[model samples]
Target: MNVAAIETVPLFEYLEFEFLLEYDVFAPCDRGRTRVHEPPELFQGFLHCYYEDVYGTRPVTRELQKPLVWFSCGFDRPPSRDAVDRFLTDLEHVVDDVFDHLVE
Candidate 1:
């Protein structure tokens, strides 16, 4: 199986920010190896980009296809100052947890 693309559809887009997720299954499989092609610009125009622009750096991505699972998340804007702080604080934890769970 092969995934051409994964679309993050916005479930809610308010003035504060946008919340999105993979609404459609881009790849389906009965059995066999599944391959997912990376998008051209994974973080373009997203809050992750914005954070990198403002904060000076983004998370270091570690690719692990051991079990062949891929996951990603992004934010467009924050509703409050606290939200911004929280995101910065929690980003590492989120990445670590994802890596730990997926690579295990």
Candidate 2:
């Protein structure tokens, strides 16, 4: 957990994430040891991008340093732009499902 993110987690600590965890959001993907971001965390990260008007991995990485976004992603530590690219790319096929799931 990042210190900056930890400082402000209480605001969302009570938030329920059970809904997002109900399904294996990444079941369609071939993720193995490289799975870093989970569904709940990705949902939170997507919300951050939606509100922040930041799109794409590079853009998301720029905003990832923000305390709220950092907390949303549940990141253990700030990741590099390349790492973000890889993570998002790995989950790219499910991006549509992610948005659809959100609307339902």
Candidate 3:
């Protein structure tokens, strides 16, 4: 994820405070010795990526927003290195396109 993009807006602006707090509290315990690590900042980027993937340019209606929040909070399991690598590699392109749309 691009630091410049991330710094432009606070992550909590997009995510609920309770959700971020819960993850901050539990992530260490839940991810006991996982080789594929995701920092909180990177995870925020993933959430944004997933959100854009699902919602496209449409306004995030309440019905559509709930599932994205649920999915982001519930996806706590550690993925395999191969899976993480693959997803992140693909995510770069997705994020680029998302940013392109945002700029336009």
Q: Give per-residue CA lDDT, model 2, range 3-90, as digits (tens).
A: 4543334534655444644455444356455545555565556556656578987788788777556755687665667666765764
- Candidate 2 pairs with clashing backbones: none
Candidate 2, residue 95: how far the Cα is off, in Å: 2.7
All candidates: TM-score: 0.25, 0.55, 0.29
Candidate 2 C-alpha error for residue 70, in Å: 0.4
Q: What lDDT does the true structure give each of the candidates?
A: 0.29, 0.60, 0.40
Task: Give the per-residue lDDT digits (tens) of candidate 3, residues 4-101.
Answer: 33331455455432333233322444547543434443345345545455332232222223433424433344334453444355445455544554
lDDT, ranked from best to worst: 2, 3, 1
In model 1, the Cα lDDT at residue 74 comes to 30
In terms of TM-score, which candidate is strongest?
A: 2
List the candidate 3 regions with Cα displacement exceeding 4 Å: 1-74, 101-104
Higher-ranked by lDDT: 1 or 2: 2
Top lDDT prediction, candidate number: 2
75 Cα displacement, candidate 1 (Å)? 7.8
Cα lDDT tens digits, model 1, 10-78, are: 311222221111212222334753323211122222333343343422321212111111332332221
- From the highest TM-score down, the ranking of the candidates is 2, 3, 1
